[model samples]
Target: MFSSGHLSFKGRGEKWNSTDDGESIATEISSVTKLEVLELCGNSLGVDASLPIAEAMKKHPELKKALWSDLFTSRLNTEIPLILKTLCNSMIVSGTRLTVLDLSDNAIGPQAIGALEEFLSGPTCFALKELYLNNCGLGSAGINVAECLIKCHEAALRHNTIFDLQVFVAGRNRLENRGAKALAKAFKTLGTLVEVKMYQNGVKQEGISALAEAFEDCPNLKVLDLNDNTFGRRGAMQMARVVGKLTKLQVLNFGDCLCRRKGSESIVMNLAMNCSAIQELRLNGNEIDVETAQKIVQMCKSLPKITILDLQQNCYGRNWSILVSHFQKPFVDFGAESDDDGSRDGDTSEEESDKSDED
Candidate 1:
């Protein structure tokens, strides 16, 4: 941690959980400024410790990234928003260089989201690019989180500032259909996203349909992970239709997403027809049979760019090899050249084959 571009005090044990420990560090490094990154997670440091650190951070004129996640347990209900505002104001006063903010695993609920409303609504623009709010107790009822992003988008656009956000991670937050709809609305307003992770959010057909419509706005999207969600046939079909619009998508993970034959066909057929750049596709445990597996193999073969295709834990039985063999095509070359000369450079082993295989 000495003289490095990043600093971490996470999981420092009970000894450094006290306010005195924080004050001592702050005092010792009060003159040091301009940290590129700082992480103080899992310290259980209460408000008293946070205050000193926030005060010390005021000297960092170019603090680009910071994380104080899981710093409190019960105090998150009241302190989450306060600490956010404090850090925001402190950065603004010093110099607004923030890009990523992680507040995950904090047990944050509606109140904390509500608390962010004022900050998002403020005239000061924040150049945030990545936001991580995973497992923060924002269930199906918590639409304020979506609203906060909407406000941020609106404010940044009106002010002509950079809201070029890319990655948004809210996985395991239990954001069901309604919450997904709210986020979709926000997505319609903003379009500079690249990756989105919303695993295990309990989103169904209605929610996924809304998201499918919103996918039209994100043309630069490359990675999308919606695994462990129970979107049925209708939802899968809707997603397939819209996902094809993202021609640049390379990685897609929807394993265990409750897809039947029709649903899986719709997805694979659409991707094969429209998205040819996809490299990795994961549809494990989707109840796929031999017919569905054959369709998947045909679709995969249609795309020359396909690299990894996962169909494990499905109902393909012994016939799963039919699908696996498509992606396992042996490397071969038609042109044959033999360097049988003993004068060849670095030919130390006689067991080496003269022929080389190419894709």
Candidate 2:
């Protein structure tokens, strides 16, 4: 079903569990002389099928992008690690320098970290620029990803190559404070990063502070999305300190981050003073009051390039209309008014509402 150097079975809903299925795909892979991109999403791949497909991967040294998300649906937890390891091994052996590797929506937990570690630190990732592992359920094991990336950076340096990773997305992984701190170390080291998105990771003030410090080193960062995380006053202030440094920032999403009144003020003030290239600014569900929202509106007026400003689900109450009128911008998304007393029940309900909105 594949032609030219590209093969894609995306959203096919095929359940490939047998070795025969693997061999068929392997045969097709071997037939492609200049294979560069392989997309295998929306299909369930078992260990049997993965083995042959992985073997075939080695034959195509030109392979650069492996869009392998949602490939292990209905698979045993034990089988996923083996399949992941097998595929990684083949890619490593192929002597190919990958540019984009996406393994999102797979639910590959901590057990799969070993395979990821080996693959990421190997020669295959020397030229990798974009890595996506969204909704992988990595939990605390997420730290391994950062550690392995550091190893990969070191390996690239030793080989006289630059590991200029540009984009990293790992949202909904529950990589709390410890995992965040570890990743901060890696991000600081890989200063070539352009975008970093780690939303819904349960990262608190400590983790946020660490990441803020790390972000100071990445001057090229354009997109920073830490949505649905908890960023209290301390965390928001820490982030505020670095917002002035990221002059190239374009999209910044901190929605549902629980940055209270003081924190919101600090961040808004910094964004107004700094970040002139900012295009989209999301501060929704941050418990911002009318007074702070006024400042945000004023900030938006100063940012000429800003296109989208999300101030939804905050403590705007009836004052939402006033704030909206002041904004004057058509791109502002001020979803629903909140309590007039500015009393936020808790972060749990707010985060749940945010998730439902996304769905």
Candidate 3:
């Protein structure tokens, strides 16, 4: 029975069943009109309780964030689609300005995909910036999610605020290369996307290659997390090419992505040269040797600023001192020295141009 700007009953799991007490509480919650954020995650609020909450949320014209994750179990099969439809429709209504929505860990299968797709494709679109749909039982059928995002990108175009729609997180949905290709298309459409996280989605080289191409267009993209996926040597080469294109990129997480000798080399080669704005770079557990690690660290030393350069779990055992020296050396020292190196002039000028454009 809560109705403030933020409603949170996260861990009260299965305490209120389909009994009268649950109905009473739901009725009270429905009447609350000041709710802007609703968080019912980690609760076993069955269909009985969820319906009333959805109805209440519909009334909030200014609802911005809703987190109803982890509401699915083995027995609750039939109600999942209905719940998804109701919530999405609520956001679609006129005067509603929902932005951040998290429906992760809800076991949402193909049954509820249509409801979401319809809502995004509808005339009345929201200014949704962040969307999280991780571990939703999507399996290989996550292409629909990418389609919905495409529609959202189209909607944002109508408003001329495409860059406002930034973060799109769909991690652990079992989306393979097909899904990645679909999202790559969407990224091309929405060129202003900042952070895109598709970690642990079984995306391999082809999918990552598509994403790498997308990076060439999205110059404003800052953070990209593809951790725990399979981006082998070929994918790494593509990634290297794309990394050179993103000027504003700051954080890149490719940890445990199965990059071997050539792949690792390709990534290090471009990143050390082109990525001047990079702050954090993760390449742990990629089977890189000591020589490659030293090269990467040495190359990264050219950057004017850096916070973290993780190379743990690689083969950089005896030559770990190279990493220490990288941290010890002043980043400004190479910036001045690299100007004298005629070979690096083009890269330096391009980086400067990108930074000037951002200013």
Taking the tens digit of each residue's C-alpha lDDT, what string does model 1 give over 1-359? 43565776766643344568668767744655547677777766555665676688888766666676776665646766665666566666666456777878877677667655654444433577887888888885357867777787777777788577788888898898889999888777788789999988988777888888887899999999999886677678889888888999988888878665677788888889989999888886566665676668767788778787776566645444544555444221111112111122234221121111000
State, as a TM-score between 0 and 1, how close model 2 is to the true structure.
0.92
Ranking by TM-score: 2, 1, 3
- Candidate 3 Cα outliers beyond 4 Å, as residue runs: 1-4, 19-33, 93-95, 123-125, 155-163, 316-359
CA lDDT, every model vs. true structure: 0.70, 0.86, 0.70
For model 1, the stretches where C-alpha displacement exceeds 4 angstroms are: 2-4, 14-18, 73-85, 92-95, 120-125, 140-142, 317-359
- Model 2 worst lDDT run, 10 consecutive residues: 350-359
- Model 1: lDDT of residue 41: 74
**Model 2 segments beyond 4 Å from truth?**
1-4, 338-359
TM-score, cand. 3: 0.82
The most accurate candidate by TM-score is: 2
* Cα lDDT of model 3 by residue, 255-324, tens digit: 8786755677778678767878898888876766656666676788776666777665664444445544
RMSD of each: 13.3, 4.5, 9.4
Estimate the lDDT of model 3: 0.70
